[model samples]
Target: MSPSLKAATAVGVLLLATACGSSNGSGSDASGLNPPDLKAQEKLGKTEGEVNLIAWAGYVEDGANNPDVDWVSDFEKETGCQVNTKTAASSDEMVSLMKTGQYDAVSASGDASLRLIASGDAAPVNTDLTPNYADVFEGLKNKDWNTVNDVAYGVPHGRGANLLMYNTEKVKPAPTSWSAVFDKGSEYKGKVTAYDSPIYIADAALYLMATQPDLGIKNPYALDRKQFDASVALLKEQNANIGEYWSDYLKEISAFKSGDSVVGTTWQVIVNAAKAEKAPVEAVLPEEGATGWSDTWMLSAKAEHPNCAYKWMDWIISPEVNAQVAEYFGEAPSNARSCELTADKDHCATYHASDEAYWKNVHYWTTPISQCIDGRTDTQCVPYAEWVQAWTGIKG
Candidate 1:
């Protein structure tokens, strides 16, 4: 599908999902699992002396990479909340860490947000307490991944799509469809790469949604047994031609630079890094659409530093800070105002931060559930736990 056509179709889906209240439900009245009885903080109070966080590596920078990249220090100084961060490499790890109840906040991706919400590991955010919440993009607010039953669970962080990256010199005609890495993967046999996670199953599910309409696969994350099996089957087939599945940026960049990977799924940041190394590569959002992520800065349900956590959430999404984080993280800023504050004037444009149409075909990752996120009551859908096992099986 052309970008415009995909966007138009996405707009329709978005409208339907919004009107229905929960993406898991069809328009009739499907709802998410009831949130546990956890109370949201009613008011902001005195800042605690310390705040510990669980986050993605780039989400919470203390200037360890470069002297000019410090946002945590300034936040700490302003609020007197000494910052301590523990980086989590995957959503499952974040979930496990949050369950320990040792952290104050987490930058939860879409896949883990619902699990946290459903398990009561995360508390509903009082947007009124976070002043910067107003500046976040309207399109990001109240989505299925961040909000439950019309209640906000976290502050919207940055977002980006998983793109198709190909070795420009080796792949002729510049492939525009996901099939180059799926259905036609044999063409690049033993040279194709993919994400190294169970969540990646959604990528195949997304492709199946576009290629095999007979499956009735509505949402990539919301797959029943039949659809889920079909997606897994496709992955098993692709696995035959896989060179290496990647979970880290540097690893994939190295693989591409060495010509071990010729084509596969990738992130914009990975593409930028590869090109910087002078590797002949290009990335695109294929016609079949793609799975993406929208992260949320969520407060722990048992937070001991509620006041400081609230302060951090508001500060992180503020114009200047958001711009810095978005640019460093290579994603579209959640705050619309952050675009103007970005050092590179073209940062927002390059990531399509403000382009709602472009995001239409980009399906943000959401946790799958038995209630059927796509609104099918006739069959139970596979959950994330099952996906983990399936991933192990496929990789084994």
Candidate 2:
């Protein structure tokens, strides 16, 4: 799936195994999060005969998408839990399907995670029950998007960082920070490009978090009016130099290849695609960091097959399985151990799979809401709808 264009998904009714319990293991405490009063599955029980799942189109392929890309078949054979999959094409559909409460688990993106949590459609995951949780990258564990009230809501699946990609020969003095595209963007004039989603506002917010500390912007996703305005203002200024806004990799690849976009934000996949086409392009996680994308496996709060759901969660994140999913999906594996098992020995290195230090500052994209995701309670933050309106005006 092209995470950039990901929006909503479809549904499938699923039966679940029963299990219950409270969990004490929450990865990190976000400042202002307060999760719903739901408990995670405590222990494994007898597997239900069947398990229903909702996922991104390519995420749960049982060889129907392709013959060689079957992860579910092995899982079914080993666990004895029949796997039924419904692929979602958008986050809106994913949320709607999850809310139906007919499914056991879902592979949700960051944009839909909080909605699931707040709506109580998702349950906190007992990391202790999922042994594979131990190998998950520290960068993906506990944070504003998937964690709340000191409780981990799900298992991180995969990730991709938005990077600063520029044409090698055209842009002199290689940039190490985002300032190359913001403060100094005039140097490139109308040749600059950026993602076109309202979420891209977080990119400008992230740059300000480093360069304009006075704005008190801690989390790029948690912007109060002042911080939001500052971020929007920055984007408005940057708009002066923006040649075009892009929402897909091909548009960006073509722009970079034609020298129409010399420097801007991009994903590793796009850079690789450009390089293969012989484009002189290089991408980096700038010193100030970047906004990226990720997916998490979360259980249904009303899961009928809780045991099977929990087992599926653990199974999907296992090192071998994680490696397969990561490689097949073209994203960095969340399981640090998965790096060692990839068929392409350099896959981990190429995707920075285990590079905690490199990913330290990368902020995965999260949906912005009124409740401060940063944990602030004193002020109301800008919601996503406002962000969309503001983004339109900035681009206009």
Best by TM-score: 1
Global lDDT of model 1: 0.80
Candidate 2: tens digits of C-alpha lDDT, residues 1-396: 332112111112111111010011223454444567987766788998789999875577687656767789988998888988887766667888999989999988777787788778899989999999998887778866678777898998988788899999999888898988899999999998987777778888888988989999878878999999998999999999999987654667788989999999877767776787678999888888777777889999988888888889998999998987877666799898898888778878888887776666677767677877666789988876688789889998
TM-score of each: 0.91, 0.86
Task: Sum up the clashes in candidate 1.
Answer: 1
Candidate 1: where is the Cα deviation over 4 Å? 1-30
After superposing candidate 2 on the true structure, give the runs of residues whose Cα lies further than 4 Å from its correct spot.
Answer: 1-27
Deviation in angstroms for 191 in model 1?
A: 0.7
Candidate 2 yields a Cα-based lDDT of: 0.77
lDDT of 1 by residue, 238-296 (tens): 99999998765667878899999999988886787677778899999888777787888
